[model samples]
Target: MAKKQKEKNNEVILALKAIVEEKGISEELLFDTLEDALVAAYRKNYASSGTENVRVDMNKETGEIKVFSLRQVVSEVNDKDQEISLEEAKAIDEKYELLDMVQKEVTPENFARVAAQSAKQIVTQRIREAERNIVYDEFHEKEFDIVIGHMQRKDKGNLYIDLGKTETILPPSEQIMGEEYEFNEKIVLYVVEVKQNPKGPMILVSRTHPGLVKRLFEKEVPEIYDGIVEINAISREAGSRTKIAVSSNDPEVEPMGACVGPRGIRVQNIVNELGNEKIDIIKWSEDPAELIENALSPAKVINVIIDEDTKSSKVIVDDNQLSLAIGKEGQNVRLAAKLTGWKIDIKNEEQYEKELQDALEKEAKEDPNVEKAIDSDLENLEKLEDEADIEGVIEDVDALKDAKLEEETLKEEEVLESQNIERDIELVPKDDDEYKFKETDETETEIVADEDYEYKVPEEEKED
Candidate 1:
């Protein structure tokens, strides 16, 4: 019986090693899982309350399993099963201290038989969880990148792609319009998002993303991968057309020629992969006006008037190229606007002239007085000049009248000052003899003067 038991333990160890090799699971993880399963089985079968703090220790070389019940050291013992007094704990081991966990063997005689039945189910569940974690970690690094996948099946407009180790989801919104998806068809996709689910990792991929075109260019063009060429921007109308702006870091290399490859083979490969969608490769410019001009390709741009404040541009083309610049239903200009990050308005020479004339007429209608001032003839200007001259002559005449009245007032004031008369006057002769005069009524005054002396009247006051 002892020899048979030894053989059984060896068989268990060999089986664990085989599982590690077959499932790609770490041996350490498997041992930890098995020990946990043993602990649970011991609690269920041997422990009285099934709530004891139990742990399992396994010998990695011999597959020997043992179960122990843990008891924490405390100042006072409360529960005998889980807590031990410090004195009792110190007796078992001199190094034991407070809060120290002391473990005692609790493995039952029939634990191996009971644990084997329970470990099968628990280990299988743990292995599944480990596999999911491994896959999630592997694909999470691939987010925002591109991957090649094969179409496996379609369900409710969603495509399931087989990516070797896992599957990814491709929804209808990310799919190209009018493009047929066949069984086992190989295609390139841009990984949009990676989500962790309970069952597995969910990878979301796209076919219509501009990033798909960018990654394809990077893969095809050696100049781009070497950092000699850089993609500035990309705008795509999937299944129809795409516009990509590229710039060169080195002055010796042309970005357009590098991406086009020799004999157009490089771009043609990408075009074929995208179901023959048209691609326009444009040179990037730092100037907004120049960039806007390049963004609208296949139709020549005469001028690009940029409004930096509004981030908009008005593109003027030849009259014959107007329809082509605007494209069918304005698709060309729309894609150009998105690529350049600007609002674009396209017009020909005649349309632009008409727009300018209409703007002037509108301004004239809004303010009629300004229009009248601008439209005034030479006759109207001459009438205004004559009215200004008449006003100046009237001002001169008024000034002369005011001067004549002032002169008359000055003469009157001079006469009054010369009279020096009062209501009662005392006249003194040259010999110092005094004579008195009094006024009785208006215009009647008695005058007293020296008879011997002659009385003289001034010529200026004679009238007064």
Candidate 2:
């Protein structure tokens, strides 16, 4: 009978070795599963098993489980089932301190075959959890990129995509509007997020992701892949109009034209893949006004007036071009807003002209001088903003006061000097040779002899 028990002990080691080899897991990590399962089995047998916390350490050389039951050190050892006195705890672990949980070795004789089976089950579960974590990390790094997903099945009208080692359940909320997907159809998906769930890792994928547009461009446009062109921004309404802004590193290469391809084939293909969606290939500009104009394509832009503080761009197009600029249901301007991070308003020439007139009339009432002044101040403000040097505040009122005072003094002196010049001519000795003899005199003194000499005088300016 003793020999049979020894044989069973050897069998357990062999079974554990096979599990570690098959799962490609270290024996030490496998032992943790063994310990947890054994504790569960121990609890099922006795109510006092609350004191049981199985500790498992695998021998490095033999890869066998060495089990121990842990108990906390206590002062009075009142609940001896859950805890032991300090002296009792110290018998197993000499370095044991008060409040420390010390492990007491549990021999094979202490447990039955049920505990061994439980231990085996725990090890299997732990190995799977570790494997899932490894898979999660591998896929999480591929966020914002295109990944191929095979349709796994369906759940409540939503499609579940199987990404080989990992699966993504694409919710109906994320599906393209008015678009239908087939079963087992291979589709490209965007990895939106990854999170850890109790069962395993949950990877969220999006069918209508803006990143999908960017990734498609990277795939089709060689300039984008070669670093000659970069996708600056993208905005999409999912299976509808998608706007993408591209910037070129090479001066000669037109990034917009390059993305559009010869005969518009490149972007057209991408559009077809997105349920025949329209694509606008726009050139990216650091200037928000220019970028907004580009983002709203198929419409000629007459002018763009932007408020830097609010990041609003008031776009003016010809009356005939208004609908094209705004697009169906304001989508063109909406996409432009998203692409450039600006609030955009598309106005026809007539609407803009009327708005301009109304604004001028309002300003005339508020400040008449501003209405008289040319709108070149608007251009000047734009220039300042472009140079990133805004807010040119008035330095001081004293400077302006000094300028006004200097102008008034100069005007008074000019009037008085004119009168003095007239008097000087009469004061002369009535000959060109006597011009030097006109003496400096106080103002209002008439040097001209009455009924004797004459001089020409300049006309005075009209009073305001």
Candidate 3:
């Protein structure tokens, strides 16, 4: 009977090793769980003993179990089972102090039988808990990444994807529109999130995510996978169309060619996977003008006007390609705008020229009197040039007044002189010839006249 009991203990130890290996659970954790379960069983069966502080110890190698009763050391003991006198505690261990717990073996001989009865049930519960944690951790690492899953079933409006160990939810919002999901069909999906629930880990995945296209390219193209080529941006309308911009890190490698592969085989594979969705893979440019031009592909772009402050672009394409550049209901330009992260406005050459002409006419009509005012001003300027010397007209007013005053004074003096001449005249006879003479204190003067002339001198001179 002793040999048989020893073999039974060995079997329990072996079974613990198997659980740890198979369930990805820590061995130490299982030992702790087993000890706790045994302690609970001992308390429930032996409750009449009124032992409140009981602990269970288990040997890791042999799986041997033991129960211990813990009592706190105190100066005075009131409860015999719970409190031990300091003196008694020090007898057991000299290092023990007041309030310290002293442990004593109290394993019931029938405890082994009870533990055997409960071990299987407790361990199985523990295994399920460990598995839930394992799944949560695994899916958490895969969030925002790509994974292959099989269509499982539909629950209400949500679709379930079988991702091997667990199922992920694909809500209607994330499912690609117009695409059929058949049972057991393999599909590629992007992991949007991983959430933990009481049932297990709840993984939320999507087929319409732009990340799915990026991951598909990474999987198909060696250059993208190896980092020679890099995807800059992606915009998708699931089951309809997608636009992806790519660039090359290495100068020697071409990003577009690398993504397209030899003879379009690589891109074709992706197209087929996405239910024949049209994809335009364009090269990325650092210059906004060049990037906008490239983004509006499949249509010949005449020019691109970029407004850096607004982060917007105006793309001009050929007249024939206007509908293509704008796409059906502006879908083409919309996807381009999303991919380039810029607001795009598309126009054809004829429409752009018409807008330019309309703008000029509108400006002219805004202020109708401007041209008339300008022409009138020009005529006035010309009249001024012919009428007066600009420099002379601009002379100081005070200087002109002074000049006029001086001229008037000179004329007044002349008038005064004429009066003096008329008043001071006189007549006299001189020698045999009749001559008129005027005599004064300072000098004498003679006047000769022609036959028709009459001369006169001052009356005072005649008297002299």
Top of the candidates by lDDT: 1
Candidate 2 C-alpha lDDT tens digits along 233-292: 888899888888888999999998999989988888788778888887888899877877
- lDDT, candidate 3, residue 54? 89
How far is 392's C-alpha from truth in model 1 (Å)? 50
lDDT of each: 0.80, 0.72, 0.79
In terms of TM-score, the best-performing candidate is: 1
- Model 1 scores worst on lDDT over the 10 consecutive residues at 376-385
Q: Clash number for model 2?
A: 2
TM-score versus the correct structure, for each prediction: 0.74, 0.64, 0.71
The lDDT ranking, best first, is 1, 3, 2
Give every collision pair in model 2. Answer: 426-448, 427-447
If both were scored by lDDT, which would come out higher, candidate 2 or candidate 3?
3
In angstroms, the error of model 3 at 5 is 4.4
Error of 1 at 440 (Å): 99
Sorted on TM-score, best first, the list reads 1, 3, 2
- For candidate 3, give the lDDT: 0.79
lDDT of 3 by residue, 81-184 (tens): 68899999999989999999999898887577777676667767777877899899998998989988999898887888889888777899998887878999
Clashing pairs in 1: none
